[model samples]
Target: MTTTTTLEPVRGPFVWRGDQLSGTDEWIFRLSGDQIAELEDAGRRFVADDPDLRFVTAAEYPLPVCADAVRVFGADLDSGRGFVLIRGLRMDGYDDTLAAAIFYLLALHLGEPMRQNLLGDVLDHIVGVSDKKYLEGGLPSRTRDKLPFHSDSSDAVALMCLRPPASGGLSSLVSGATVYNEVLARRPDLAPLLLEPWHYDWRRQDPNAPADTYTSPIVSWTQGTFSMYAGGDMIESAHRYPGVPPLTAARKELLALVEEITYEPGVALDMDFQPGDIQWLLNYAALHSRTAFVNGPDRAHQRHLLRVWLRRDVDRPLVPRFGKHVVVAAPDARQVGPGDDTGRFRIADAATIRERWGD
Candidate 1:
């Protein structure tokens, strides 16, 4: 495989701390009462014009935006610094339908690429709940728990905060390119391991499907840009095969190095989320984590966020190991249900996913 020496650098606005990163109170689009009404009305029009467009569908699909909205969202911002957190929206008064609708519209107007099968594809949404097992497995909660740096599957992932944990749950972000560059400068020998293919546990896949594992690289450069999807557990799991070295000492070291640099204040950013505030990031360009949080007494008010993966229209080529295209099976071929075969799965179909939500 050919590797390009010049990779576009990863860049972001804030730095990461142990449980918090520097963040701006400024919002990309702060809607006033009139602006909110106009936005809601525009959202309704967009949805009505396209009946198939649901909250989850909008997360997966891209809708044409008027030049005005794009300008308001500042689409011209650097791709590496794609994260924008909108503040001052209220979720308490809105029903699930309206809440989802607003988030979908905001995501569409942002125009970031959807990585997962969002619109025309299947499974457009993912709801993260606080579970003991899942939390232990590295999913973020509201309780100020430290999350390891990792990338989700998509060009961008947007999380709409419906509720915040009573304490903690601060959001953190780090640039993958920044870490890679640090490694290259400090430990050049480990840099190449990041470019090699490693296996990942397909957490979203069918349980019975051959262990639901796929292999890809931690870092890949296509054309002049960089793309990364890294996780510790997933890479370690690749050892299930014979003849595979024990996590490749270099890989482990590289992961450690990347994590160290990412946790630094110069490279990471932290922000506290409010209800109705949405945080969106360019997944390929950056890595993000969340602090563990403590939820409220009422389960309904527990920390809740909606996730949508997007594939954007860009000139970047697919990395060989990362596998650029979305893979789908016939609906009939797989069991269609509210949850995965494991019974804990949450389907992303826009129209029916909310019904399947446990809380």
Candidate 2:
């Protein structure tokens, strides 16, 4: 795990400042009518089959008309920028099941959908069940708190907005490459610490997970390639577990500095989630966060977004143990269906959540 801390600035299409991108629509891909029609037609047929979504492959749900658009999205995530927003799907006539089907269909074209929870659910509902904070042992996705910029565990993560909040749930993205450049410019000495291993709370991901803590460097530079996995919150939480090493004062300062840079005017690009809008981001290239929001009276009116984590066929080069054990796929990995009992395949109600998380 030892390597020289190369201080040369990482220059690439991925190294972009958010302020510079405010005037550009290049990061957005609005679906054409024909493509929407193709999705609608395929969505209806796929829903009719009622196939287990876990088993559905890209070949099973070919996006002949929209495949090229998806490819462009992958390229944007991997080579151009770190993220892309797909717009132009009207959800007025469709229900949640149909929306989930369409979202999953698009995800299939992007990559192989991975399980998001111990329940082996490929599709995750990002709805606030409570106003709890991550430090309070609550899942960030299930809480209505402002989340710090961080990368999810997978090659890419996608979210489709099913419902927007009444107010304030703006999503923000920061380029890891940009953050690195800033760090090197401001704190070259501490930049190398980011390449050193840091512990993360594995139990926070799943109480029943095999281990309590897992370790990985925040940034990985291999063969001149740069990538990052920002989890400052998780690293902070890991210290609460026994046997996890405590963060030094210098390390703490470095973590705070990294977070501070992410919020700088030009470092973060913010967006409002709209129904049918999908955001796809590469975990290694960028980190993302959300502003706290207010929810409506009941479940029907609550802010809801469907999320999927995907493992692309074409993997990025990373240092050894960079993100090892981050995402524990279903035991079967490829085949998850009803009755196997890995975990719920759909959104769990309050009771179900309480049963599993004891929150």
Candidate 3:
């Protein structure tokens, strides 16, 4: 679906680089000791009622302190700066299940969780599973591979650290606004091209999904609000479909410029994660990536994170193409799953995750 109305050039004000972002703690929230206690107590009660619980259920009983933070965080994710980090959760004695429960609990207040894959997974385990079989083609989340700068299929994407890798796995985040600003400065002709729609691969889609591909643009703006939906990996893979329009020379150049800008020093902020750290990025305004990680000789030291993709009650205005880019959660949907299945995400241990899916 394309718009026929001629739109003017968009030059938004949120554009910014790492030098301007990394120096400030305005985006960081360090939990106080009282808040930590509040969370631990909440987890105890939650697990008692249901040891294996999802966020939707845990959210029934709220932590007053966390409730306040989630309110402000929701605002920031949409308007202010577009990213926030929650710190100081003591991870020393917590189990993966409990930590995930707490993380998911906080996320419920931010927005409803979206299914992360066609398997109908609501909660995602960001750990490399033994299955590398799907990586040859599909957008499988279980891998040690590096992720290109991209956004997820939701209004906001979140991850909570469970284990720190022995090496690598640092997160690199770049602002779409910053990249757009740079493009406007260097190649004004490319600015408008970014507004045009391009098809994306449906690798993460289940066999039961409505389509094998979807269309969207890298940047979208309404009035003064700016939104972006880019997944370099997915865009490149879309070309495999003969019907999808190929990237023209100018489009290719724009893609290359995005890659270069995301990697250039001082442009993207690279963060080394701690076990208790939780990161949330506004999908529209931020693009993030991760380096390939290595596990220590001891399997216990392997890296892992819990991931959640959310759709807020309040979200930015989107281009017509956005319908294909984001998956909206149903109000009565009790469990998070794909359009075709009843799947429950189960965390087996700190090192492994188990989910029910029929391949």
- Ranked by TM-score from best down, the candidates are 2, 3, 1
**lDDT-superior candidate, 2 or 3:** 2
List the global CA lDDT of all models. 0.56, 0.80, 0.72
Once all C-alphas are superposed, what RMSD does model 1 give against the true structure?
6.1
> What would the per-residue lDDT of candidate 2 be over residues 1-359, giving only the tens digit for each residue?
12336678899998988888878888889999999999988888877777766566779878889989988998998888879999999799877777777888888888888777656667777877765675686777788788888888888899989888878899999999899888889888788898889998788777786788889999898887899998788899889988887888878988999999999887898888888999999889999999988888865567888888888767578888886455534454446533246554432221033323424
lDDT of 3: 0.72
In model 3, pairs of residues that clash are 120-338
How far in Å is the alpha carbon of 211 misplaced in model 1?
5.7
- Per model, how many backbone clashes are there? 26, 1, 1
Question: Candidate 1 regions off by >4 Å?
Answer: 1-28, 32-34, 43-50, 53-67, 71-80, 90-92, 109-131, 135-146, 203-212, 241-245, 299-301, 323-359
- TM-scores, all candidates, are 0.73, 0.91, 0.87
Best by lDDT: 2
Q: After superposition, how far is residue 140 of candidate 1 from its true place, in Å?
A: 6.4
Give the higher-lDDT candidate: 1 or 2. 2
Residue 175 alpha-carbon offset, candidate 3, angstroms:
0.5
lDDT of 2: 0.80
